[model samples]
Target: MLRVTLEQWRMFKAVVEYGGFNQAAKKVHKSQSSIHTAVHKIEQGLGVKLFTVQGRKTQLTEAGEMMLRRANFLLEEAAKVEAVGQTLGEGIESQLRIAVDEIFPQHLLYKVLEQTSNQYPLLRIELMESVLTGGSELLQNTDVDIAISPVVLSDGFSEELCHIEFVAVASPDHALHRYERDLTLEDLKSHRQIVVRDSAIARKKDDGWLGAHQRWTVSHMTTSIDMITKGLGFAWLPIPAIQVLLDTGRLKPLPLLQQSQRKAQLHLIFKDGDRLGPAARAFIGELRYQCMQLEEVM
Candidate 1:
């Protein structure tokens, strides 16, 4: 038997959160007296003082502070329970909108999508290839159900998927490689550098070193790689994306004293993990499995 009800705890939290009975009443669409009565009932039922009144101010007592923490967990768990019920009531989602960063390997992405589609043939998918903050922005705007990005959303849930290695590379005959010694940052600045533009419209940003005096900013990674292969410029590219070129001797890694290679961690971010439908869950499972397989081989 519980001394207090869930509604009483909710009212108690509302009072603490909104700072006063009157404010909480307005926020919760209840009368001020009802809000006061609810908190009073909670304090009486628990046999503890939950708030103290100073000159024109209501503050929580030490006991209230601890109760607030427990109350938060209680409410969150209750919400999750309701979300699970709602998910069960609805069938598998008909469509899934996913935003994937361009930096991720295309082969792995295609493999996961293929597997997911095979399982749910009726499911429609909208795949957006984003860059840098673009994926996070789509998530924040509720434009996508999931985002695979190096930039994690502060307000959303995320799990690390994999690490991508980027190596600085250029054509074998490029001016930087002609030095015949470990190139310094100063030596590379004189030549053209290929950079991919950030796709985010609102808050665009640069990801790596932009110290080169001359730069050619393109919209796609393929364009940057193509430019590098033609000896138009040098750029740092993901190893997975350029592995074939490296193996074929068409692209050669730059001999830099430091920072010749860097790693970026990609994460799978969800709009609401608890409320995901069966199709979305299946897609996430397949994505994780594929990433695991890649890790084992590396």
Candidate 2:
């Protein structure tokens, strides 16, 4: 059995990631000699040359590539273990950056943040309200740890959470609901309409899915809601987002497209396949759990 120190494996993984010991040492806050020595010890223990050094630059051997794969797995598992302990312990100061679309309300999210802050007193929460499309791109670039977006998931990312449904709504005085029967796309087109500020909405119209022209556009759902409250136009909104307004009779369900209203999806997106940190993973868990609870009621 080969026994490799965690530090040695870390040095090796750093070298693989950075492509050189000198750069790896700088990143790990260690001297280049120290990193070289660690890798040397690992190679000695395994009885294989891990790297092919032509000069100051080095390339990974077959053994190096194999070890790199295992080393990264071990490092990730160890990080999870460490993070689990840190999560239980109090007073570990950390910062978490999260991006969310405006579909979710600040008051509700603030409650979640308050609970997290109370439990993890030292954790600082930084929130940014990014539109769905822009937020997805930010998540792909790893600019934000996690993002709540409405895009369908694809390869190279994880859809950690999604449970909300989109519903068609309008103000009580809107013409769509006055007929007391389901409204057709033809009826919707007869009136000027407010639409979500997304290029995708227009594309849907052009494709005949919406079958109407939009009279106005707004950046956020709240803007749409506000506009509808003042009788601007009807639009689709997340059920949970507009539930309060609906309950208060500020908004009325058109139910015109009830038969065709497909549930829209909201996804919690992450970068690099599965390299999520503890804070990011925990937040994803909470968001999923809460959304699941909401789904039960719907």
TM-scores for all candidates?
0.69, 0.59
Model 2 off-target regions past 4 Å?
Answer: 1-93, 105-108, 152-155, 199-210, 257-260, 273-275
lDDT of each: 0.91, 0.71
Q: lDDT by residue for model 1 over 97-185, one digit each (tens)?
A: 99999989999999999988898766789999998999999989989999999898888699999999999999988888889999988
Q: What is the lDDT of residue 237 in candidate 2?
A: 71
Candidate 1 colliding pairs: none
> Pick by lDDT: which candidate is best?
1
